[model samples]
Target: MSEAAEKFETAMPAWKQWQEAPWGRLRYAIAEANPLRHFGERADEPLRVLDLAGGDDGDALRLAVRGHHVTIADYAPAMLTAAAGCVAAAGLTDLVSCVEADANALPADIVRGEFDVVLCHNLLQYVE
Candidate 1:
């Protein structure tokens, strides 16, 4: 893993806690509207989305709830575990999936061009 990824992996526990807090939920609620606004005309269609460095997959769950297929990818395995739990809790197993991967070097199976939308919120600052 890259240095940034390792650092994030170490911080996953704290991250998970904060993500369940009010502010985190608020942040996701605010950001969730973007995809719908942008894809307003295609509301009936199921869009494929990728949430890069999407720890805990809160945002992915939101998108999935909107009827989109979402993949939450993070370098931290713990984050993916938490994300999986969120997916299950939301009962969105058919719409959301998790992948452990480095954002700097994502696996070929998750090419950017394959997704209709790519959510990269709050991830760039950690990239190196």
Candidate 2:
């Protein structure tokens, strides 16, 4: 596996634990950093958004709840699984998709601009 993938695998447990915490500073940080508002008030149309390094924390799921079609991509399978569960729990299965792919090497289809918004949050630190 690539170094980035290895690091993500190593960090998955801590990430999960961090996300499990009750409404904390991290939650506020995520809300503050969220890009959804930038999409503006005319966000009725389901926007195709890509979330790189998106853990199982439900940030993308929150966007989906707001009527966005979201793709949650992560290098770690465990993270992707967690994201999927988050989507399911939110009853947003139709609005969210999960992919196990490294951020550095996104699928060709995505590189071709399949999404309207691409998020690379908290991922650059792990990239080689």
Give per-model TM-scores. Answer: 0.85, 0.79
lDDT of each: 0.83, 0.74
RMSD of each: 2.0, 2.6
RMSD of 2: 2.6
10 residues in a row with least lDDT, candidate 1: 1-10
Q: What is the number of residue pairs that collide in model 1? A: 0
- Candidate 1 at residue 79, lDDT? 74
Residues 43-97, candidate 1: write the lDDT tens digits: 6689998899888787888788879998888987767887898889889999988
Which 10 consecutive residues of model 2 have the lowest summed lDDT? 23-32
Q: Which candidate is the best by lDDT?
A: 1
Off by over 4 Å in 1: 1-6
Q: Which stretches of candidate 2 lie over 4 Å from their true place?
A: 1-3, 22-29
Clashing residue pairs in candidate 2, if any? none
